[model samples]
Structures are given as C-alpha cells and as structure tokens.
Target: MADIERHDYDVIVIGAGGAGLRAAIEARSRGLRTAVVCKSLFGKAHTVMAEGGIAASMGNVNSRDNWQVHYRDTMRGGKFLNNWRMAELHAKEAPQRVWELETYGALFDRTPEGKISQRNFGGHEYPRLAHVGDRTGLELIRTLQQKIVSLQQEDHAEHGDYEARLRVYPECTVTELLLDEGRIAGAFAYWRENGRFLRLEAPTVVLATGGIGKSFKVTSNSWEYTGDGHALALRAGANLIDMEFVQFHPTGMVYPPSVKGILVTESVRGDGGVLRDAEGRRFMFDYVPEVFKGSYADSEQEADGWYSDPDNNRRPPELLPRDEVARAINSEVKEGRGSPHGGVYLDVASRLPAEEIARRLPSMHHQFKELADVDITAESMEVGPTCHYVMGGVEVDPDTAASGVAGLFAAGEAAGGMHGSNRLGGNSLGDLLVFGKRAGAGAAEYVAGLGARPEVSQADVEAAEQRALRPFEESGSAAAQHPYALHGELQQVMNELVGIIRRGEEMSSALDELAELKDRAGHMAVFEGNRQFNPAWHLTLDVANMLLVSECVARAALRRTESRGGHTRDDHPGMDATWRRRQLVCEHRDGAVTVTERTHPPMRRDLLELFDITELRKYFTADELGEVTAEL
Candidate 1:
C-alpha cells in the first residue's frame, strides 16, 4: 500500500465556497474540530463569481416585503415546484443570515437611513437583495474568510496553534468518499500541487461543492464545478432529485468566442436594462406566458415607468424569472432577429447614465471592457442563454440537510429540492448561508450522539488510490484516449441535445451518446507526466465525474416528459399539472444510472395558505387542491 497522510476531524467540509465556510464556522462555534477542503485556493472558490446580491426579505427598500411575500414569490418563480418547507425556511431565515454577515464584519452598501441597501433582481417581487454593489459575491467570500481568520485567532490564543480547532486545506480535491457500513467514514483526496494522497477520517461529511455547470460546453461555471459532490453522493449510495431541471441563465457573453459563456449579471436588467432584438424591439414582452401575463407590463411606457414608480406599474417582462428570459432569447435568435453574434441585445447604457451604470454595476462594466472589449455603459451587449446552474442535486432532508445515507449531508447548490424547477437570482448566496449553518449544526449534533466513530479501512483507501492512478496506468496503452477530447465530446453532447430546450428524442440520443462517452472515459489517459501541478491529469479525473453526472441528467431528462421551469421539453410544450406533483429521482446501481419517478409530499397547509386558490389552480391538480382546501 502507498504511504498516505491522515488527519482526523469531527467534521470534514468538501469545498471552500460560501456554504463550506459557513458550515465550518458553525461547527467550530459549536466546539467541534472541523476541516475545510477545496480544489481552489482559500477565498478563490466560485462563490466569488456571484455578481448578484444575496436575497433576503429585509424590507430595507420596500416596507411591504417580508418572509411570507418572499416565500410566495419563491414558489411562483419555481412555478410551484419548489419544496415548500425549504422555501419557507429560506424565506424566513435569509434575513437573519444577511444580518449575521454584518456581525462578521461584512460591509454592505447602505441606504440613506444607514440600513443595508437592497436591490432588484429577476423573479423577486421587491428590492429584496442585500448587496455590496455588483460584486456582492466577492464581498460575501471576503467576509466569510475574515470570520474564519478570527476563529483561527481565537483558537491560537487558547491552544497556541492557529489550526487547533479549525483548518483549511486548499488545492486539495476529494476523489472518493469512503464509507463504512453505508455510513460516511472519510474522504480520499490528493493535493493538486504535489499529487500526494491524503485521508481525513470523519464520522460526518458536509458536501457544499456547488453545481454541475461545467458538464456543458457553454457555461458560466468555473473549472471546479465538475459535479464533484453530486457524483460523490450518488456513488456513496445517495439519491439525486430533479436531475433533469437545469437552469440556463438568460444573459452570457455571445461575442468573442473565447469568452462566449461568461456570465452577464442580471443586475444589468435589475438596474433598468432591457432586452432588444436586432430590429430594436423589446422582444420579452411578446414571450410572457399566460401564467405570468398580468405580472409584467404590456407596454413600453409602463415598463419604463416601473424604474421610478414600481408601486404603480408592473415590472418589465425582462425582469421575469431566468427561465422565461432565456427561452425568450432563444426564440428571438431562432427567429433571425438576433444580434451579429447569434444573440439578442441587452441594453443598459440607453436606460441609465454612464456614471450610474459604472457605480451600480462596476464588475459587469469591467468584465465587459476587459474580456469582450465592449463598453457596456455605451452600447448594448450581445447576450444569450448559457448553462448557469443545475436545480437538481443530492436529495436531502429539508430541516437537517442530511441525505438518506447516515452521516452524509449536503447544502448549497449541491443539494436538491430547495429550488424545485428554477432558482431566483440572488437566492443562491442566501441558500448557502442558511443551509450551511443547518448542515454544520446537524453534523455536530449527529457526531455528539454517535455511539462509535466510523473508521476508514485500509482496503478502501488502497482502492481509492488505484482508482486515482488508472489514467497513469493507461497512458502507454494503444487503446488509450485523450481526456481533453473525451471531455470536449461530452460537453458538446450535453450542450447540443439536453440543453435549455429539450425533446424526448434528443434526450434519448443524449443518453446514448453519454453511454458511449462513459465507455470512452474508462479508457481516457493523460500524457506521461508527473501528476504534480498537471492540469491534464486533474481533468482526467474530472471527466469521469462529469460523464457520470451527465448520464444522470440525460436519463432523468428523458424520463420527464413535460415542460416546466428548467426542464423544457419542446415535444410537450405545456407544463403538466399532474407532473408538477412528481419528481424525477436519479440513483446509481449496477454500474449504470437509473431514474425513477416519485410524488412530492404535499405542501404544509400553513404554507399553502400563503397563495390564493386561483394561483394554486394553475399548478396543482383538482385532487391536490381539494386536499389542501380540506386541510386548511
């Protein structure tokens, strides 16, 4: 057996993003020794890429905004497919999370009265997002990192070592989760800088490793989002829910092939930007579905008036949920009204003064000027749909963030059922803070109650090491394939067939292609080189995870035959009331992925009362509606 480094912790957190840091802080505060591990450097997790603010109904900007209203908007934005309990908790707890960040030394932009400033974003009914300019995510990470440092300082004073109670392992990637009798034992990982193996034996593991956006060719996700946590959970005998519903954010850069999929923050539209076609027509107005008809303005005059007097006028259709906007852009481009780069025009310069645009959206202005060489404050940006987030992920308990697998918990984008079909912009950061704390508390409680700590067996560690070395062993073989080529093919297959708009036949074909890719991935090899700092070797491991996750997505998508939220099936263009009650669950067994359908638990009667019967009728079946009414 190869020599491997070993460490023990009460809780091991995989990923150093907002969720991971929050979870670690909660655990350490609860007096548990905790470890945070990530594939990127400390404070460089993809959470920094979140341009929009954190969603919380603090009502700093609108007195009418509260948890109930926020909850209602969240359910509506998800098309009534959200987990009602999770949505309720998120709405109720997000405000406290934002306030807590201030206690951790976060400096949010303030209104005239010295309260946290709130801003508008898509799918939100009010100016509900508490932000620090357009770089809210960066501020969030900075604040969390500062909190961690403070915790370390406290530990150093007490124990004469900064890492006495909490530690951070950056540039470390967990390749496999070791289990003991179906429970989480530890994680097997390698240092990205040296390729040496290490093990962290813990009874509880919290997976906060973001989403699977990198599985597609055109995506706004960073390299670390290769669905590591999702794949790990599945392989550890956990189920993933709603794997079919993937969110395609409406606006990504479409010009300059190199930066085609870079994100264009929704803050642009939130701050009075509009989407136009080549003919200079605001095309989003034409694409509002019947369900969303009265909520959006029908005329240009009404929409423009909303910026100044939102209380009097309905918002523009451009401020609709992300799914609606992305589909609208797709329709415009397919109808030949697209910009020169096969996208629609997003115009913010014409609505806001150049100075205001620079102040409100500094990151966006700099991102565009530096990458695409387009001055966002002077002209419209060529923007279109790009894969942004996956609504599906590891299925877990709403209250605890615990999977069916004992000792294994998930939160943030890695967990499913929170955003059932679609996620509202700004909701993600709040989700991280809210659930990260819950997961940490849950893991601490679980550890406190355990009879015996789970142990990692030497055999399992050896198997993990061999699994990590497969690419090296296959390097000199004649049948070996390049990992990059396989990765490219997998991305193309997913981007083309199972993307924003889906069809039965296309998804079926995608599953077939994914199966082929999976077989090829087994033979993928990197050029003979030392694993130290080798990106090709790292990609060789990531490709397998992406292929497995893509298979789950394709299989679940093929089984779901209705158009709703992120899983839009052109063959079945309307959302099904019956289907709204069902969720597609993905599981792995017998070396293949299988998808099964299950009904969602009825929404709590109290939560159901938040919406009117008229709104409920659009999404719920007559039988379900009768049950709800009778329960009420």
Candidate 2:
C-alpha cells in the first residue's frame, strides 16, 4: 500500500504564490503552525511571470502622491465599483509592504535621486508602479522565498504546537476539502514527487490559489492558474462574488498559433510606446475624450510636449487606460486598419531611445528574440487582447479575508471585490500583499482560538478516493480523453464566446458547451502512467477545476445584462445604474450552481470624510448615497 501521511497544522495555505507564501510567513509569526502548499516548483508559481511592477503609494517619485490619491486612483481605475474598504486598506498598507520587501532584500529599480523608481500604468493619474526593471514579480518572489527559507530554522516552541510550524510542500495538488459539520476541518492532497496521498488536518484553511487564467485559450497567467481556489471554495459552500468581471489585457502577441496570444506587458506603453494601425496612423485620439483628443503625435516634439502638459493634450502616448486601448485596437481591426494577424502595432521604438528600451525591457527583448524571432528595438509588436485577470472570486471581508464558510479564507486573485470590475495593470501585486497579510493573520487567529479539527467521516474520504481511482479502471485506452485536448477546447470556447466582448446568445451557447466539456471530463483517460512527476495527472485535476469555475463565469455573465467595467455585453452597450446597485454572487448547491445578486456595500462612515463631497456627488446621487458601508 502507498503510504498515507497525516500532517497536522493550525492553518493550511493551499498555494505558494506571493499571497500564499506571505500568508504562511505571517501565520508562522503569529505562533500558528502553518503549512504552505503548491502544485508547482518553488519560485515559479505563476507569480514569477508578472512583468509589470506592484502599485504602492511610496511617494518616492512624486512627493504629492499619498494613500488618499492612490485610493482614489484605484477606485476610479476599477470604474468606481470596487469594494471601497478594500481599496482603502490596500492603498494605505501597500507602501509599507513594498518597503518591507526591500528590507527583506528585494532590489527595486531606483530613481536618480536614490528613491524607488516609479512608472505610469493604465488608469493611474500619475506614476504609481514601483518597479525593478520589467521583472518586478521575479524580484518579489525571490525576496519572499529567501525570507521564508531563513525563517525555516527558527524555533516554534513559543507557539506550544511545534509540529504546526510553517513548512512548504511543492508539487502537491489539493484534491478535496474535508468538511466537518459543514465547517472546514482539513484537506486531502497528492504529492507529485512520490505520488503519495497526504492529509492535512487543520482548523483553518486559506485558499490563495490565484486566478483561473488557464480557463481561457489566451492569457498572461501561467498554467497553474486554473481557478483551484474558486472551485475549492464553491465545493465547500463558500460564495463567489462578481464572477462576470473577467479582464482581457489588450496586448497579447498574435502569431504562430502555438503560442497564439502571449502577454506583452503594459509597461511598454507606460514608457512612451505608441499604438498604431498597419498604415502607421495614430488612432486612439479619434475615439478618446475631447480633453485627450489631440494627445498623441507622429513627431517626437509634440509627443514630448504632452508629457509636460497633460491638461493641454492627452496624458502620454502610452498612458491610456486598458479599456480605452482595448476598444481602440478592436476598432482598428474592425475598420480593416489592422496587421496581417488582425491586431494593431504597438511601437515603442519610435519614441524611446534604443539604449533605454533595451535596458528597461530586457525581458521583452529576450522573449521576442527567443520565441518570436523579432527584435523589439527595431520593429513594432503585433498585439491584441487576451484573457488575463479575473476581478471576481470567493467573496470575503476586506478586514479579515474570511469567506462565508467559517474555516475557509482567501487572498490574492482568488479573493473577490478588491479590484471590482477592472484592475489596473500594477494593482494586483498590491492586492496580493495587502490581502495576503490579512488572510494569514486572520487564519492564524482563528486557528489559535479553536480546538482540534472536527472528525473526518469515512464517506468524505471515500468520495474523493473514488474520484482519484476512476481513471485507472477504464478498460479501453481509446475512450480516455487527453487533458491537453480538453484544456484546448475549454480555452477556445471561452475565448470565442466569452471574450472581451460578449452577447447573450454567445454566453448561452458557451454555457451549453461548458456542460458538454464537464461531461467529457467524466470520461477522460490518462494513458501516461500515474507515477511521480506526472504532469498529465495534474493537468487532469486542473482541467476539472477550470471547467467548474469557467461554468461559474459563464452563468454569472448570463445574469449580468449591462456592460460595466470588464464585463462588456454587446447586446447591452450601456452601463446601467442598476449595475452599481449590486454584484453577482454564486454558490454550488447540490450538484448544480446557483447565482444571486447581493448589495455592494457603500464606503464606511469612518473613511467617508476622506472623499471630497464634490467627487461623491459626481458618482452617487442624494437618494442612492448612504453613510455606512457594511464590512460584510
């Protein structure tokens, strides 16, 4: 018999992303026995793929920048549908967190004045993203990994539960939630290295498993982002909020069909790049506001002038918000002014000096050379939108990061309502840090006060046990479906029907196709041996999670009629006032999914004084306005 191991912990964190690792560190510091689990290699858990910098109010580049301004910008960038409390907390805490990373030895790019360098990103009013060249994510992860590794030798005797100390398990995939009396008791998972089944018994569990980018065909996110937390929370009876707001980044490379749409970072634009048609026409100015109408210029002189006088012209050639840029690219392609790939040209070479482009965007240059065989310094990149981030996830309070399910909590991209309908390019890193700490501290506190985990019934274990073994019993090899093929089909369905723009018929048909994919998953057969390091076996599990969560997205999209933020519906072109009233919330009941609308609480009274009355009046009316926003 394969050895079954029982690992006891005060809290089990089911991811190793920036959020997950950060949570584990905090939980350990709080005297809780913590275990950080992941399904990929250490330092490569999708977080390393983040190219743009983290958004924080460091006020290094501009002394005028403050938490209040950052908060306002974040709310505005999210189209004012954000959880005001989360935005407030994130804005206030992010600067401190980023500095803490520096203390832990993260090497951020610095300004000539010796402070951390900041850059402009889509939707930010000013330079806000604190970066390290173009590979901010790598620096962040490496810094955290070093910190956690250093802490591994620390004594946990003060906690009185030494066995519950923080430990990391790489290449482990969580299979099911072990609920006791409808409360989170623990979880069961498989280790990819030895193909061993391990049981984690904990009173509190934090799901920071990141976003579900793998659900779509083209995404900037890594393969590990298969919506594991979303599926796990739904199965455990936790409610997911705002599943309809999926953000498609408007600059994925469209070539070679193999890597159909790889993400091209927004920093290229932030550093004075320009978007143009195949005929080299600057197109964004035609569709933008009158204030920004004469912004971009073909010559270097006018373009340089806009940088100094944004009020007189557009902000900058590369400083447009993602929504505006995405629509601009769409119009270009629609009007037959697109490249051979049906995408527009994103040219940074014409504006920035060659030396600066190579130094600031070395990774961009390297990737194109190795993958696409194009030199970005001399040629324009073909770009279009690809599904990148999800604004919706398991609903939780901003203060606690605790889900509706008692023992379950979430953070990072898996947690909902922080970014609302659309997240700014660099805000996600801040969201990870701010909420990751909250979830860890909260989970630790919860576990610290609780008694041992409740009983794990035989039936619960048997259900998961049966599911794991079902693939092995199939007699015919031909009947078994390959995991990659299913994943491909899922991505195609999602990209075609539920893309940046959506229609009622497309969404409805997508739902039908999702049902069929789920059915196909039931009969999937893995011809590869179910041994250690079986990438296919893990792909199978990931596909199941992706299917479950993608269905949640399609169903939620169907219920939301109006076009708001990232969830645009072609059938309903206008943003309805009713959309501002609530968010779409979903929960799995019995064997099916159920979605409902819930009130999006207003800004809390304690913080209402911070917002100027003029801005409040501009957004909300006298009757619709309220004094207190509920934390729940």
- For this target, which candidate reaches the highest lDDT against the unseen true structure? 1
Q: What is the C-alpha lDDT of each candidate?
A: 0.92, 0.82
Runs of candidate 1 with Cα error greater than 4 angstroms are 627-632
Model 2 pairs in collision: 33-164, 481-525
Candidate 2 segments exceeding 4 Å error: 155-164, 289-303, 306-314, 475-480, 605-622, 626-632
Q: For residues 358-475, what per-residue lDDT tens digits would candidate 2 score against the true structure? A: 9999888888878888788889998888888899999898899999988899999999999988888899898888899999999977776777567666677767766766665552
Clashes of each: 0, 2
Candidate 1, 611-630: lDDT as tens digits: 87877888988998886756
Give per-residue lDDT, candidate 1, residue 335.
Answer: 86
How much is the lDDT of residue 229 in candidate 1? 97
